[model samples]
Target: MLPPTQTEAFDELPLVERARSGDDSAFTDLVTRYERKIFRLAKHITQNEEDAEDVLQETFLKAYSHLGEFQGNSKFYTWIVRIAVNESLMKLRKRKTDRTVSLDESIDTGEETVVREIAVWEDSPEDRYSQEELRGILEKAIDSLRPAFRTVFVLRDVEELSTEETAVALDLSVPAVKSRLLRARLQLREKLTRFFRRKGDDVFAYL
Candidate 1:
């Protein structure tokens, strides 16, 4: 088993200082600390467990190799996340290219469009069950978004990164991030509305 992660080991300040000073252990600890988060971000962006794992591993390795180049301007976690996101985006691009030939057919958008309607229900037994179902469905919906929109939504909404931080991670202007997020959310809403149309009355009755 690996050692404790950096978050579990040193505080961020000490970890940054030690990492800056070429402490391999500190870097390892940092990797341990944020590895799951990195993988999660990758999973969100890539929408594939295998790709996410690869992205996570590559991100940490890259971070290790480039540690010397870190200027210490941002928090270490944020810097590492930037790397992870880029890795995920690159993988997404490659996957899109690989599957481009199969894009002619319009397949069903799947269960997510149905589950998005769960938002209409709240506090009832049906609502609770629907919410649980919606969570899984939302993942599929998010996965269906374009890479840029998906990244923005994950950063700005799911991960709750600030607009500035998300912009930095995505290498977009703040306005660009905002615009993408808005469009993504709207698309999600539209997709979810399909389910809502069928279940809206039931949801309102329960509420």
Candidate 2:
């Protein structure tokens, strides 16, 4: 949900206009502004650093190649995200021959709704673990989700795209995005709950 600030939004228009008019450096500037964010989303979706890198490269390459086709209908970021999402899914298809889960499938609701009270970890895991360790754990937990849930979660929660933007990027309805996001959050909370529970009194002393 990290959106560009007012200054960033102001800066982006000219870059996009110049880039659209065949200015390579302008396009490069656009890439510089968004590459890290896009890479994070790609990594979460592909669940592999190498694949994520490939997706990132391919996304920008395709965008540059087809820059003219980009109408001003959506934000430049959203347009690039659509490309990245497509590239990541293509990579997944090539990597796995079997059918992947559909985004429309029903979520399992065996567990009770995870209370929001528990959702607020007073001392977040990030405070306890080194950056690298926390990243590993987060990646692992996200990877544990089904492809459908994972994509929605990454786009909506991780990337902080609005529900509409997330739905547009993933080609899902807004309600569908909301449904999957809730399920993804619950599933992730359950995993973290188990992890903290295993750490004994030190982590969950407040409970």
Candidate maximizing TM-score: 2
Candidate 2 residue runs with Cα over 4 Å from true position: 1-10, 106-122, 196-207
Clashing pairs in 2: 1-159, 1-160
Question: How many clashing pairs in candidate 1?
Answer: 1
**Model 1 over residues 82-126: C-alpha lDDT tens digits?**
998888877877877565322122323333233344444233423
Q: Compared with the true structure, what per-residue lDDT tens digits does model 2 show for residues 29-142?
A: 999989999999888888789999999999999999999998987888889998999899888877877867455555556343456434344365566778887788888999
Give the TM-score of each candidate.
0.72, 0.82
lDDT for 1 in candidate 1 is: 59
Clash count list over all predictions: 1, 2
TM-score of 1: 0.72
Task: Quote the lDDT for 134 in model 2.
Answer: 79
